[model samples]
Target: MTVLILSVFVLVYLGMAIGRFPGLQIDRTGIALLGAVILALAGAIPGEALATAIDYPTLFILLGLMILSAQFELAGFYGWCAVRLAQAALSPVALLALVVAVGGGLSAVLANDVVVFAMTPLLCAGLVARGLDARPYLIALAGAANAGSAATIIGNPQNILIGQLGHLDFWPFLAACAVPAVLAMVCVFATVAFIWRGRLELADASPLPLSPPDLDLWHLKKALLATLVLLVFFATPLPQEEGVLAVAAAMLISRRFASRRMLGLVDWHLLVLFAALFVVTAALARTGLPAAMVATLANSGWAPDRLSVLAPLSLVASNTIGNVPAVLLLMQVWPSPPEGALYALAVLSTLSGNLLLLGSLANLIVVERAAASGVTLGFWEHAKCGVPMTLSSIALAIGWLWAMGHVGW
Candidate 1:
């Protein structure tokens, strides 16, 4: 049973790192689901224990946030923001700064992946229409999304999980990460601007038609109201999952958008991914090998409980298996981690994901959308900006956390 569980876990994480099997169409979500299924069939995790293995609170919170973001999407709010950014009569460098600013700011509150998904194509079309190179802007958009999402727990999937599991306060989490996130956005603008210098204009490009969704002022008003209510809940003693779920339910009572459409827009793929990882990790924990290994590692001065160790580990783990999965895996192995360590983990894992194109789902979404828009944003092209931006931002995060006495060496 132990061997079987370990084998399944290894195969699933390998799929995560490589993104897929050589000839299989299965993605990280599928890999995780399959691992859980394998464990259940082999009796590594009994059907009765399945319920205990999954964390439903985390899923509910994710679903609620997705619904909130979907409201913005259906109202054409995200597209409108992108169009405005593109249509602004700013210079090349100024335009880059605006892209980073808008992308980061929106991502700090909404789901970063969804924000990038809605903005990428429209932003690309607008830039190309203006005869400007869209490559740098797209890269900055992805990096900004990653960096900005670090500011709040609800900003990204990994941070959401960390916040829920760690029982982190919303305001304090924001206070801890806001500065690093802001500096990271600056890094995004600087790195992209420096690398794409003198290459901002495209002479032969013609104006491409923008296709943003028609603005629904009424629905946008409702979204804003719901967002304010959510903030109120966060400030109070009310449970986050319950409050957000309530807000999502109220949004569903709308006459403009159908419940089916709103729910469909939610990333069920990501939700399933989180559930599947929870099951897989739980099954492995039943083997007791993880606790033993952690004990040995802790005694050897190599535990992920300190700033120095966690920073590098987060960088490698986040860039490899991805930040969400890396955080889930670490939570399983690291028993009863300190609150400060949790903050460090959340900030470091998120910032480190900006190191490469394959680092975050937001980055991949931007790249894929750009490719569809005839803008080639290759791996090395992104790395040129991502590498430096990530390194600098990560350094800033570490310094801030350490100086503030949030974490120890």
Candidate 2:
């Protein structure tokens, strides 16, 4: 049973790293789900234990947040912002700054992946129509989303998991991570601007019609109200999952928007991935391998709580198997980590995702949408800015973490 669980675990994570099974259409989500199912069939994890393995609160919070972000998407809020950014008569660098600012600010409160998904194509079309190279801008936008999403517990999926599992407070997390996030956004702007200096302008650009987004002011107002209410609850003693579900319930009561459409915008694949990975990791945890490994690592002075170990681990694992999966693996292995360590994990894993094009979901969304908009953003092009931006931002994050007494030697 132990060997079977280990084999399944290795295969699932390997599939995660490579993003698919060769000669098959199975993706990461499918792989994780299959692995969990295999373990259950093998009696590695019983049905009752399997049910207990999943963390429903994390899923509920994710669902609520996705609904909130979808309201903005459907109301044309993100599209309107993109149109505004495209029309801004600023210099290339100034526009880059604006892109980072907008992406970062919106992602700080909403889901970063959804923010990029809604804005990427619109922004790309506007830039390409203006005879400007859209690659740098697209890269900067992805970087900004990742960096900005590091600020709050509600910003991104991984942070939400960390906050929920760690039971981290809203304000202390902001205090610990906000500065690093801001600095990372600055790094995004600077790195992209510096790398794309000579290629900011295009001579023979294809012109396309940039249509305005369909605006629904009333629905937009409701989404804003829900967001405001959510923030207020965060400031209170209410459980985050309950607060999120309450707001999501209210969002479903809309007269203008259908609950089906709003729910459709949620990333159901990701939610399934989370549930599946929980089972996979829980099955492995039952084997005692993870706990034993943690004990050995701690005795050898390689505990994840230390900044040096966690920073590099986050960078490598996040870019490899992806940040969300990486976080789940770590949380499973190292249960009940220090509060500061949880903060470090959230911030570092998020910021390190800018190092490669496949680092974060937001980055991939930008790339795909850019391709649809006739703007090709290759891996090397992204890496030119990504490598430096991630390094500098990570350095700043480590420094801030040390200064705040979160992690140190």
Candidate 3:
């Protein structure tokens, strides 16, 4: 049973590496679901074990945040903000900075994925109208969204999982991550500005078409009010995950928008993937392989010494299997890392998402949307910004962590 579970785990992550299973129509979500079922069927995990393995607190927090984000989206707040940014009479360089700042800032509060989905089209349309190259702005928006989300516990799916699993408090985690996140955003702006400068200048500055009028003001106001209330709760010393989530659920119920429509905005596929991944990874945790692996490393005189290897390893694993699963796996081996190492690990893993187009879902969404707009950001184009942004952010993170004595080495 242990061998079977281990095999399933390896195969599932291998699928993640390849971005999908070969010769199958399955995506990451589908592969995860299949892996979970295989573990159950193979007797590695019984139905009860599987049920217990799912992290309901994490799931509830994620669902609540998604609902809140959906309310904002349905009210067209993101679109309105994007349009306003577009109409600002700044040069392309200034405009890029604005987009990155605003995009990144919002991502800290809302899910990065939803922010990208809502903002990408408006940005693309705005660039096309102004004859400015849209590619760099689109890339900046995606990269900055990922960078910004690293700052807060509720910012991204991976962070949410880490916070729930590690029981990290919101404010302390924010303090640890804020520096790295800020540095990452600056890196994003500089990298994109350099790459797109010439193209932006050469393009004609024709007047753009008017943005579609803002959505219902009343609904937007209500969503804004709920969001502010949630922020106040988060800012206070109150236990954030459940408290803020209850606020979200309340907002969802009070909506003039139909319940079906609100629920439809939820990323059911993503939620399913999280639940399945919980079972699959939990099964692997029970297999004892992680403990054996750790012992082997310690015996080989290769025990991780915090600043020297673990930090870089965290970035690599995050890029490979994603931050959530990588952090989950790492926690089993290094259960009680030094004071701030867990938080540092979280920051490093997340900021590394900018290293490649496939490193984060936010990047993929930007590329996909760009392609749909007849402007594709190929792998190399993305790496131009991703590499520098990732390197700089990691460097800054290491410096901060070391200064704070978070790393044992």
Candidate 4:
């Protein structure tokens, strides 16, 4: 049973590393689900244990946010924002800054994936209508969303999981991460703008047509109100997870939107991924491999006591298996890292997503949307901005963390 669990864990991570089995139909989520089943079937973990390993608070939060985002999408809120921003007639630099600012700001409040999903089409359409090169704006959108999400506990899945698991406070975590997130956004704007400066000119001066359609005012109002209430709750002394769940329930009960539609928008696959990882990691933890590995590193004078080593490792691990899973694995070994190491880990892991096209889901969405719209944003093109953006943002985070003495090492 132990060998079976370990093998399943290895195969799952390997699939994550390679993204998929060559010529086979499998993805990270599928691989993770399979691993969980294998572990259960092999008697490494019982079904009840597997169920217990799943973090319902985090899952509920993600589900609720997705529903809220879907409601906004149905109301055409994202389209409206994009059109308004694009119509400002700003210069290329100003437009780039606006994209990053809006994308980042929204992402800090809403789910990063939802923000990217809604923003991508609008951005692509707006740029195409303006006859402007969409690559820089698209890349900035992806990078900004990922970076912006680092600011708050509920901003992204990884942050949500980290906050829930680490018991990090909402406002304090934001305070710790806000500066770096802002700096990262600025860096994202500058990097993309600088690289694509010459390509920002509009080839056509035609104004894009906006046809008014029937708006779902009630649904939009309900989602907006629930979101605002959730924010207020987060800002208060209430239990974070419970408050979020309450807001979600209120939204779910409202007749303004169908519960079925809202529920369907939830990313069950992502939740499954987290649950499976929890079980697999739990099995690995049972083997005491993490302690042994940490011991080996400690003996070699490579302990996580140094921010220099810790920060870079966090970045690399994040880009490798994504920020959420990376945080889960790292937290197991270094449960209570330095005072602000958790926040630093959240920020760096998110910012590191810009290092490569495949570094994060947000980047992949942008690339896929671009491809569908006859605009190709290959990995190399993305890396041109991703590499620099990632490096600069990470450097800024490390400097801030060190200067503030947030991390003793």
Tens-place lDDT digits, model 3, residues 310-394: 6678668767887666766666555455547677777888888889887888888888887887887899988887898788888
What are the models' TM-scores? 0.97, 0.98, 0.94, 0.95
Worst 10 residues of 2 by lDDT: 201-210
Against the true structure, candidate 2 reaches a TM-score of 0.98
lDDT of 2 by residue, 1-409 (tens): 9999999999999999999999999999999999999999999999889889999999999999999999999999999999778777777678889999999999999999999999998998788777788888899899999999999999999999998888888999999999999999999998998888888865544444676687899989989999999987776778888999999998888777788999999999999999999999999999999999999999999999989899999999999999999999999889679999999999999999999988899998899888888889899999999999999999999999999899884
Clashing pairs in 4: 307-409
lDDT of each: 0.90, 0.92, 0.81, 0.81
Candidate 4 local Cα displacement, residue 291, angstroms: 2.2
TM-score of candidate 3 against the unseen true structure: 0.94
Give the residue spans of candidate 3 off by over 4 A. Answer: 232-239, 298-305
Structure candidate 2, residue pairs in collision: none
Clashes found in each candidate (C-alpha, N, C closer than 3 A): 0, 0, 0, 1
lDDT score of model 3?
Answer: 0.81
For residue 206, model 2's alpha carbon misses the true position, in angstroms, by 12
lDDT of 3 at 335: 49
Worst 10 residues of 4 by lDDT: 208-217
**Residue 264 Cα positional deviation in candidate 2, in Å, after optimal superposition:** 1.3
How high is the lDDT of residue 231 in model 1?
Answer: 82
